[model samples]
Target: MTRSRATLALATTAASAAFLAPALPASAAVTKGLQDQEMTVNQPGLTPAFLTAAQEANVGLVRFNTRWDGQASAPDPAQVAAIKAFATKAAAAGIGSIEVSPNISGDASFNPRGKGRGPKATDKISQDAYRAYIRALATALKDVPVARFYSAINEPNWFRHIPQRGGAILYRRLHNIAYEEIKAVDPAAKVLFGELLPYARPTSKSYPHGQSADPGAFVREALGLTKSWKGRGRTASYAVKADGVSLHTYDFQADPSRKSSKRGRDAWVHANLDWAKADLRKAARTKRLPSAAAKRIYLTEFAYKTSGSDKLSTSKASSYLKKAWTVAKKQKVRSFLWYQLRDPTSTDELWQSGLQTRDGGVRSTWTTFKGLR
Candidate 1:
């Protein structure tokens, strides 16, 4: 369908109409589960072996980071080949859903183009490229059964990203394009919004003030959180555009010292997550839908890294995972997808959020997580 036609269909979902946001039955379908996929390395074309592992883990969703430039720039034969293979396996395993990001600034292609954050970017090419890229990618994956949900950006509100692009405009347009096209392809499918990074205000007195967690700030900005914050132009008007919302939690990032102690770590996880849950629900209520509509948050990307010189111990990792699951259940969250399936590369320590190590071997946390009901 043409872009204009697609938008016309979604635009029909006016604020006055009480539309039923249709979705697949959660009963026969899989319940909310962890995501185990990363960007650092390419797996062997989504092999049967990997499918077996994901199925064994009983995960309902296998999340993949769909980078717009990475795949579309060269359309890497191997990478495209892997995505097709992965989709097939996920369908067979009943673990379906692909969450994608358009503005992957850190990647070699976009990062060099410019620097700064939020929705209003100084780089014209980078910004325009990102929008066109997402539209193209969304069109490509529109037919994949396993590709159910689409998140416009990875984490735009995060300090590392936001300061470069600006926050409000980035998400508003991204979501506008994604929601319009995704629904056009399959109106029954669910499009999740705001995969916010979960972090709390730093407790350290050394760090300066005015910096809050990325997700919180994004919401505050997106919904016009404050009276003084001037909004970017309204390229796309906001409505209850998405079926669900998304958030990513990793408490370890909040601590300046990066301590692995039990008390310190647990506090970080709880406080940050609690803040996220409350903020998301509030945003959804005010900006998304009626106060009674079933607005939900999907913890799509979350994990504790323990592979550095002083990573969390295996026992500690397991404990953290358990506690996270507990909190997720308590929060009445829609679903929780862990950060990764396997650490596909060793190039960066941050890439080690997977349940398996660099070599594809399972971690104790993986074993513990696989047993979750």
Candidate 2:
């Protein structure tokens, strides 16, 4: 999910109104029309423009990543300052919530070859360091008025991020640690399990790097691990401790509107959500993991590349975006965040999925997104 470099860029409440609103039924609590974007807030020139567009689209939520490796031992003063600035700016812009996922680059000492894709594989921060970093981050951002949501890591199922012998186990441990540490500092904040990249099949032929864990099998295994912890007298299963599950639905090599029947490793776009939800339900059936079934699904990253060989025409992209929202609504997803606000570069095929051109001009799909209810 790496992209070309570009330039950079909450609010709180009415906190009482949100906290005091009679709690809606679980189904009702699921945010049906809220839309968000996954943007690199640290990019210069980018954040301001993205914020303007978000306000125009009536988007209230924004998701971004903060690298734990960058702040593992001690808080990075610059990064912390940037975060604060971004939060302040966002709140003034009428944004309501900011979801930040800490990117955990694996421990190099444990795996010399490194785990994860590209630079992520070279991240050497230890588990304890990761815990310390998130705690520090949560404490630093606690005073910010905007609702804060924290996802422990980004895409654990991606091989380059967790390439060790027991990647899934390692991920579960990391997520639990983050959840505990974040809550200890900001109890009101919501902690989400790291988002999973939806793969149509359980495994891929792109060996080594791409033979990542199947999202379905990975969740089941992760939940089973959490369930076992309960039997060992842990206070609560990790499966149920986290607020929600995050997933990316980027229908690679297939049309977003097409349904996929294949299971375990299919990359079909439309079927990924259904398969993921079903997998969660199935995992929860194991008596030890019953609560897993109740978590809300957050589609945190989704987009269609517009310049790649598999690129969809701008008109087609609009149609797909519409359908994506329709499916998300039907699935009762808590949030539907598109991959990005602006393309990183006009030439990078992989990063051209943004609703706007590289220079921040609107694309055909921008109207489609703005029209989303």
Candidate 3:
């Protein structure tokens, strides 16, 4: 998150991979992992370091995000090669699974931050080009047998990744295309979607134009579960389908077990997982869309900020993380990833949640992460 060292993650060729881990016991049903784009992806030389540290903390899985740029027919060959190499190295290190998401910075590929008349409206990558990019990357990985658990994209509900105006509709189209392309490359490939942003404003009106939609609204609209927000519906050429729904469940201001007292509100935070799970179940069974997707869930990214003003500077992350694991088990989460491993020196766009602190030492939360098992 410090923006200097974002690299790759581990991988599995298929379900039959010999490195696949045994299922955890009931008390440790959740697969605890880390999502440090920096330490895992950027610093290959540091692999042995983090691998040892992860083993110390009992982390078995890692999530890596690769930012793909330009309209090249595919992702960068060098990056893919590095990722494949990392996958091999990680598997050798006893890492059980990996999740990779190829993301595009800003709203489009025209420029890093398109903000002009020509760049703003027309900045989007065409459907054909995007399809080709996803297809090529997935194809390349699949050939190497590395296209294991692929996330369609980062948080589409957030304004930073996508323009909030018609954002869910746009993400739905992209996700469906990604699904088709990845599945076309490897029919058995596991594709996951919707690492939705967990934070929500207090009121519906709080999300004005250009601001992001809440996770609940984004899910209903993107999945075409509502009459008003029906996007390229069941009859459309592209339908929404995924093996599991992923969400970010950060509740930094309070304990993860803390619930909102607001009545009739659905924000989809950690405390509202029941609400989130119900929605997933409905989608899995709903006739409006394909019932191919299951009610499975993945908590792809979440952590409490230890130093940020947003966290009020006195929060106890280690304790909350312990409770978070309990909540995850109760909710039957398929995967649980802390947002990052090590913290930056200071002031890193508001995210300071790390099992290891900026001092390059483990936090009490590091033990908390291990105590999940």
Q: Which candidate leads in TM-score?
A: 3
Q: Put down candidate 2 lDDT per residue, 266-312, tens digits, no spaces.
A: 34245567756765655455543445423577777778776766578
Give a tens-digit lDDT track for model 1, residues 1-373.
1001111111110011011122333542224454443321253443565667667876666565543332233222333344555665455555655555443433322222233222233342244555456555555655565536667666655433443344455565556666776576556556777766554345344323222344555565665544333333341344447776776666653332233444332132444555455555555555442233224666676666666543677777787777767777766666667765666454543445667775678789889888876
Candidate 3 Cα deviation (angstroms), residue 48 = 1.3
Better candidate number, 2 or 3, judged by TM-score:
3
Per-candidate TM equals 0.72, 0.79, 0.81
Model 3 segments more than 4 A misplaced: 1-28, 69-72, 107-123, 143-147, 201-210, 227-238, 262-264, 288-294, 312-315, 345-349
Arranged by TM-score, best first = 3, 2, 1
lDDT of 3 by residue, 1-373 (tens): 1112222222211111123343222243687778765555555565566777777767666777766542446776655665666666565455666676766555333213333212331245456677888898787667443336777667666554555555667778878888889998788677887877775544233333423557877777776666333344453433577776778877666677878674223467888888777766665555433444445677888887766465623237777777788899898888788886777444543566667765568678777777776
Which wins on TM-score, candidate 1 or candidate 3? 3
In order of listing, the candidates' clash counts read 23, 21, 4
lDDT of each: 0.51, 0.60, 0.64
Model 3 vs. true fold: TM: 0.81
Over the full model, what C-alpha lDDT does candidate 2 score relative to the true structure? 0.60
